[model samples]
Target: MEGLRHAREELRPRRREGGPREDRHRRRTRHRQPRRPSGKRLHRLRRARGRERCGGPEVTATIAYDRPVSNFIDKLSATGHVTHKSYKKTSVTLHHNGGRLSHQGVLNVWKTRPASAHFDVDASGAVAQYVKVNEYAWAVGDTVGNQRTISIEMANETLAPAWQVSEPTWKNSARLAGWLFAKVIGERPSTGNLFYHHHWSSTACAGPHMDTLYDKVLAAAQEAYDHFKASHPVRVSNTEPFPGASFFHTGRKSPIIAAMHHRLVAKGCDLYQSHANADVWGPGDVKSYAAWQTKLGYDGAAANGTPGETSWDKLQVPNV
Candidate 1:
């Protein structure tokens, strides 16, 4: 036992000559300032934090859904976040990610968060769809707004305090908005139908850069919508042949007149005021038809309110 004790004592660390807590007490550590991260280290740290904030990298799995539109590059279904109930989309609500989020980043975020947008446009103008257009995306901060709107989330090319999208992103967004206005809403692109996220929510979404360029973007969208309409005109089949010119005379009451009125209004020749378009012909119909005739290069008497067979055929009025 003594020999064992001696061996253990020899294994113990020897006390120094100072005798100030050197025999058995633990040494106290001196406090020193931490070194700041270098530029590259800071960048890496920011990137790592961003990934965490956006729910890490992109997910490969997705749910089965119809690909209604062909413009998008791919789809990452936010099925967990969206409402399965279908909605009648009346307008489009635009939003910005408020950070430098990529297409996959936006999808990744939606996977974990309870919120989602129907579409996300990246910095390079590539589009990624999340929630289906017919369903409700938990965006816009309001239930009615979500039910009525097709929400679009845009990625920032420049990071916040600026949060500006790239030129290609803006152009592609405008193009997408135009297509939606024409095909989805079946109406012209206007401020009434194309709305910002701030319109419904209390937050300043869409960012400052987009807010400044709202009018410019709206104008571009209008132009693109016009182009889309011109390129893809509605092919309404004529179920009824052109009635005689006398059929367009005053006191005429027929479904054909109402159909013609609708067609004329669609062609941007609306002259109705104070009353709805009816089957009975009236001064409004005359004026509207005259405007249509003028648009068809008719002049003088030829451009009179009377509907000519050539103009009537071109109008492509549908049967009631």
Candidate 2:
């Protein structure tokens, strides 16, 4: 019993000493100052991470604070056709064909017609920019209002069988329009800024498709504007090669992949396939990787296959 009591007494002091030491350590930690954010800042850090994952340039342009197109400084340049004239600038207009022209035939019409617009968005979602935003085109005809408004012509052949715009076409047009709205209005285009051709004229220009796509276009524009505002620009690699790898042969080319390659090339990535290539990812992809590696000072002779962290990092794939 005596030995046991002695041992307990000896251990109790040690336990007491340890408890106070831990408590003092925790209290000191609690009183210490909090760490500040890094030099990049929280928002910038998020944007940088997003760019790393998306493998593309971070969208940075937005229309949140932009001025309306009418407020643009260069709205008096009269250089294009003056089709139909109007006197009112109260409404934004939209238009579509009334079975008078085919999708492929629009170029000829625009060249020969007295009227032209700022944009011609095709059913395939391919947009052709004809007139500059600040220039006065003959699209709306009336001399007084022609210089004050922007016009867009949607591609359509018929309005029967319930007017419908293809998914790709609608989405692409919405994106383009949204970009234009931001550029002109100094803010993203909204439902208020969007209008149909028939809204200003007695014609059914945008056709039945406009009814279905109106809300969608507005929503898409808003989404794009938000994304643009939250994005940032960062330096990215322009290569597509991985070391010690072989290329895979996918028989079919994905349009999205081809589009990605084209965007990369436009930003100075060296790709083997020309813009006219069949959108296929193959040896051409290897060429792109090699080019990126060369840019990054990698000279160890890497080939195309599954891209590695080095290549992806260079691509600035957004981390999101």
Candidate 3:
């Protein structure tokens, strides 16, 4: 009996030899599993994903982050910081000769003082973008006006008696202004959504030079608008006619009809079928007008077919 007990005890320790191998197998399986990324590495991955989705560099690398803020409160108050409460710019306001420095010198001045403007027009008519379109800068003062306006400062010493905005400066400013107006207001520069800083504030910004070259700036603006219209023509209806009017007599060349025809053509409306020209208002134009009116909830009756304030309002035709 003692010999059998001794042999059994010796065999018991050898039987437990498989425990080490089982533990080693578990350790290998744990090591092979993937690890989760954390900290700065994870942040970088998330930012790259965002850049891919937005079709451009992430906001932090763009003009959105380069804007200057004086304090924590100023940073908190900056526009475009929050998506929900973001400011929607509606108009482009022009300024000239206020900075008392040439366009080339403006950058140096900005570097020292940290002033911000949406755009700066140089004496030679070059344009410099200091801020992004989606954010607001401290260019304009009136709180209400600033919220709705995008300011473009032109390099000129307007206070100086000899200062005059050069032709290149005027042309560039007009072009930029027109582009912003078309993008925001859905209207061309000729439609007059572009305004001077003086219009919004008591100070003369674009200066006296703007007064003389106003027509030229407007013409350049019109060119920009034409380009926009050609690239992105919008469809328009013309059921509405000028108020206090019956059937437009084809004999008299009505300005209202002319304006309507021009707008329709700009919008890519098929005018070849009607054979309506700008010089004459004719019965053939009625179908196109009626279609627009019907879209605007006016019945096809002649009484309702006549263009009125409601129709004009719906078409958004300027100066009807």
Best candidate, TM-score: 1
In model 3, the Cα lDDT at residue 54 comes to 89
Q: What is the alpha-carbon lDDT of model 2 when measured against the actual structure?
A: 0.54
lDDT of 3 at 179: 67
Q: How many backbone clashes does candidate 1 have?
A: 0
- Write one digit per residue (lDDT tens) for candidate 2, span 250-286: 5424343465466457658755646566366666666
Give the C-alpha lDDT of model 3. 0.59
lDDT values, one for every candidate = 0.75, 0.54, 0.59
Winner of 1 and 2 under TM-score? 1
**Tens-digit lDDT string for candidate 1 (1-320):** 99999999999988678687664343544454578899999999988898889898544432221112222223444236777788888898889887767766776676777788877766545456776677888899998999999888887766778888666566667777777777777888788988889999898788888998889889978997887778745443434446557556676566668888889899999888734647889999999999999999999999999988899898887744
Residue 298 shift from truth in candidate 2, angstroms: 36
Structure candidate 1, residue pairs in collision: none
Residue range with the least summed lDDT across 10 consecutive positions in model 1 = 62-71
Candidate that beats the other on TM-score, 2 or 3, i.e. the better one: 3
Which RMSD values do the candidates have, in order? 23.3, 23.1, 17.8
Candidate 3 lowest-lDDT run of ten:
61-70
